[model samples]
Target: MLPPDFTLLQVVPELETGGAEQTTIDVARAVIDAGGKALVATRGGRMTARLEADGGRLAQMPVQSKNPLVMLGNAARLVDLIRNEGVSLVHARSRAPAFSALWAAQTTKTPFVATYHGVYKAGSGLKRWYNAVMTRGDLVIANSDYTRDHVLAEHHLDPDKVVAIPRGIDLDRFNPSWITPDRLSELRDSWGIAPDDPRTRFLLAGRLTRLKGHMTIIEAAARLKAQARNDFQILFVGDDQGRTGYGEELAKAVSDAGLADRISIVGHCDDMPAAYLLADIAILPTTVPESFGRAAVEPQAMGRPVIASNHGGTTETVAEGVTGWLVPPENAEAWAKAMERAIDIGAAKRTEMGLTGMNRTRQLYRVDAMCAATLAAYERVLDARRLTGKRP
Candidate 1:
C-alpha cells in the first residue's frame, strides 16, 4: 500500500538492539519489499549493518543529543534532508529525536509520525513538556493500549490522532520445533542445569534491573525455598547493563536467603529461543509497568507459560488461567504462589497452556501483522495529506 517511489524516513536515538530498533528494521524491510525506499537517521549502533542489509540507508545525525542548540541544528539538518532526498514522511521513535523531527516535518510541510515506546517518567514540568513532543505528530503510534491510554491521560491530544499497535513477536525465530534438543542441552549445560534435571526451571529474561523485578524474583525464590519447595531453579538471564552495584546486591540477597544454589544470575543470553525451550516457565516480574511487555510475549510464542506481573501491557497480553498467570506486582508471596501453581499444573497442562499462548500470539502479535498494520497507517496518513491538498 505504499505510494510510488515513496521514501519513509525513520528517526531514532540510536540503532541499538531493542524493541524500537528491531521495529525500525522490520519496517524498513517491509518498505523495501513494498517497492519503497527506507531511510534511517540515527547515531549508529550494533544493528546499523542489519538496517543497511535490509535496504535502509543510514544517515548519521546527532539526533540523540538533548542539547537545545544541538536539537535545533539537527532540525535544520533534517529539514535539508527532507527537501533534498524527497522524504515522504518523517517517523520518530524516541522523544529526543522526535523534537528535531517535529520541527523538520513542520518546516518542510511533511507528514510526521511518532511512536510512544515507553511510559517515560515525566516527574517535572520541563520533563513533561519534553515528553510531550511524542504526541505532537500528525499521527501518534502507541505500542500498546496501556501506552495509548497513558498518552491520552498524560497529554492533551485528539483521540483520532492516536493508534495502538502492539509490539510483535517473530514466531519463526521463536518456534519450539526450530530449537533443536542439542541447543537446549548446550544452554542448560551452560546455565549449570543438568540435562535430565527434574527441577522446574523458572526463567526471567530481560535486563537485570531493579524495575525489571530481579530482586522480586529473588525474594520469591526465597519464599519458595522457605515453603520447602526445593525442586526448582530460578534463572535470571540478562545483562546487568553496567549495574554492578545492583547486581552485587542481588547476589548478596541470594546468598543471605541461602538460595545461591537454587537461584543463579546468568548474564545476557543471545540465544533466547533455546533458553525458552530449556525453561519450564518464563516470568516477567516487572515492578514498574511496561509500555509493551515483549518479555511476556516472546516466551509465550515459544510455547512457554509466562508469569507476568498484573499490570500494564502484560494485562493485555497474558490471558490469566489460559496462556499464563498474572501476579501482583512486587509481591513476592504472590509470585511464589503462582510459581507453585505453575509447577503443580504438571507437564501436560503446562503444554496445553503453552499451546494456547502460541495460538494467541500467532493470531494477535505476529511481526508481519504489526508491520502490515503500520504500513496501513502510513498509507492513511499519505491519503489524508493528498486529499487535503497538503501533498501534490
Candidate 2:
C-alpha cells in the first residue's frame, strides 16, 4: 500500500518481451490498483498497450540508447518529467536507463529504486562501474536470494539497502485448468505436431541466445537419438532476436544429427500456457547463472515438471527429484541422462511431481504477493526519506 496521491515513475529500456518488461507492467497495474498514479518511461514496444490498458501512463523517450550523450540527455528529460508529473519516486529496471534515472532522481531529490533483474558480467573495471549504478538506488530489489547475495558481493553495498523479492509468476495465466483443448491444438497445429503422435513432448522456451544453451540442448538431443531413443519431440520455442547465424547453426546441427524430425525450432509463441500444456517436461539449460529463472517456474505453474540447469535461481525454485531434476549446466550427458530418467519415470510419477511443483509455485510466486512486497519496499524508502527531512 502507498499514498493515494503517490505518483511512481518506472524507467526501463523498452516495453518489449521479457521477464523485466512483464514485471514492469505488473508493478504498474499494482500501483494503479492501490490508488496511485503509474508512469513508465521507455522506448515503447508491443507491451505499451497492455500497460496503458492497466491505466499506466507512458513517457516515450530514447531511454534504450547506450550512448553517453544520449543518457545525459535522457537524464535532463527525466528530470523535467519527475518535476512536472509530481513523481513521488523513480524506479529503474535496466542498467543503461538506470544511469539516466539515477542522475534524474538525484538531481530532483526523489527517492530512487532499482531491480537487479540479471546476474550481469563485469569483465573490466569500466563495466563494473557501469553496473554499479543499480546499487546507487535508495533501495535495491533483487529478484532472488541468490541475486541479493550476488549484488552484495559484487558491489559491496550496505546489506540493509538490498532485499530479495523473487519474481512472481501469473498462476492464472499458466494454470492447466484455464487452458482449453483448442488452445493446445492450435499451438500443436502451428508447430506442425501431429494430433495422434504419441512422443513425449519437451519445451525450452526463451529467447534464442548463446548463453541460453541451445547448443547444449541440441547435443543432448543427439545423444538421446544415438541411443535409439526417438520417441521424444524437443521443441525450441523462442525468438532468435536477430541472431540469424546461430539459428542456422542450430538448424545444421539438428540436420547433421539426423534428428531434424525429433527437434523443432519454433520461433516465439504468444500463448506460453498452451505451449507448456503441449509439453510433458520444460527445459532451461542456460550456460550461465540466471538471476531468477521465471521460465523454470512458469512450466511448474502449468502442472508440468521441469528439468533446468542446477545453478542460479533455479536452485531455489526447483526441488530436485521432487518437482523436477536439475542437471549440470551445459553438460549434454547429464541432460541426456536426466531426460532419460524423466521418460522412464512413468506418467503417474511425473504427474505427481508436477502436482508438487504446482503447489510450491502457487504458494511462493504469485503476482499479487510480489507487487505487495515491492510497494512495501517503496513505502519503506519514502518513509526513510521523510524522516530525513527530504522533499517528497
Candidate 3:
C-alpha cells in the first residue's frame, strides 16, 4: 500500500496499445486500490476512459510529441502540474516522455522512476544518449531478467538500482475455466473454425512485422505440408499496425509456398483469451528477443502450451519441455520440428503441458503480484528519499 499523500504520475506516449500502455492502466488501478492517487500524463487514447473509470486522473498533455520545442514545453507544463498537484513521484514508460518527465522531476525534486520496456536499438551515440534517459531514473525497472542484463551491459548503472520485474498477466481474464462455451463458439464461428474440425490449431500472435517471425511460421507450415502433415491450421492473429507491405508479403509467402489453405492471417483479435482456447498451442517466434514475452505467458494462463523462440524473455517464461518448447530463434527447420513434435504429442499430452504452464503462470505472473511489486518499488524509492533527503 502507498501513503495517502503519495501521488504517483506515470508518463507514457499513449494508451492506444501494447504492453507498456496496459501496464500504465494496471498500475494506475493498483495505486487507486491502495488508497493513493494515480495520475497519467499523455495525449489520451481509447484506453483513457478505462484509466479514468478506475479512479486514475488524467492530465491531458502532448507528452507523445518528440519535437524538441514541444518536449521543452511539456517539461515546463509538467513542472507546473507537479507543483500544483503535489505530485509525489514521476514514473516514465518511454524515452520521449522520459526526457520531459526527467526535467520536471528534477525541477520539482521528486523521485523519478523509469521502466526499460523494450530492448531498443542504439546504433548511434545520439540514439544511445537519447535512450539513456530511461537509465537516468533514481531506480530503473527492467521488464525481464534478459532486459535487466541488457540494461546493465548497455548503461552500466549501479547493480542495486536496476530492478527486474517481469511483466504480469491478468490470470482471471486469461484463465480457461473463465471462458464460456459461447465465447469459444463465437470466435470459432468468426474465425471460420468448424465445430468438428480435426486439425490442430496453432496461434502465432503479434504485430505483423519482420521481427515477429511470421515468415518463419509460413515456412514451417510449408515444410509441414511437404511431409503431408496437413492436419494443422496455423493462424497469424495480430494487427499489421499499418505495415501493409509486410502483411501482403506474408500472404504472398503463404501462396507461393502453396500453404494458403493451411495458413490464415487473421488480423487483430480483441478476445485473446477465447482465441487461445481455440488453439491447442500458441507460438511466439519473434526474430528478436521480447523484453518480456507477454504473448507466451498469456496462452499459458489459458492452459495452452507454447512454442516460443529460444531467446529473450521466453527463456524465463516458457519452461522448455515442461510448460512449452523453445526452438532456435528464426530457424524455420527448428520451428517445423517443434510444431511436428507438438502434433505428435497428441491433445492429451498437450493438455498436460498446458496445465503445468497454467499453474506456473498463476504462481509467477499475475497482475496483482506485479502491481504489488511495483507499488513496493515505489515505496522503497519514497522511503529512501525521506530518510536520506535525496533521490534514491
Tell me each candidate's TM-score: 0.94, 0.97, 0.96
Off by over 4 Å in 3: none
Q: Looking at candidate 3, what is the lDDT of residue 171? A: 80
lDDT of each: 0.89, 0.92, 0.92
Instruction: Compose the digit string of candidate 2's lDDT tens values, residues 233-254.
Output: 8999988777788888888988
Sort the predicted structures by TM-score, highest score first.
2, 3, 1
Better of 1 and 3 by lDDT: 3
Give the distance in Å from residue 145's predicted Cα in candidate 2 to where it truly belongs: 0.3
lDDT value, residue 62 of candidate 2: 99
lDDT value, residue 217 of candidate 2: 86
**1-392 per-residue lDDT for model 1 (tens digits):** 78887999999998756689889998998888999999998988878998888778999999999999999999999999999899998999999999999999999989989999999989999999989999876788999999999998999777788999999788888898899878888887888887678998899888767898988888888888888887898899887666688888888999998998899999888799899888989999999998999889999999989999999999999999999999999998899899999999899999999999999999999999899989988998899898894431
Full candidate order by lDDT, most accurate first: 2, 3, 1
| Sliding window of 10 residues with minimal summed lDDT for model 1 | 383-392
Clashing pairs in 2: none
Question: Roughly what TM-score does model 2 have, to 2 decimal places?
Answer: 0.97
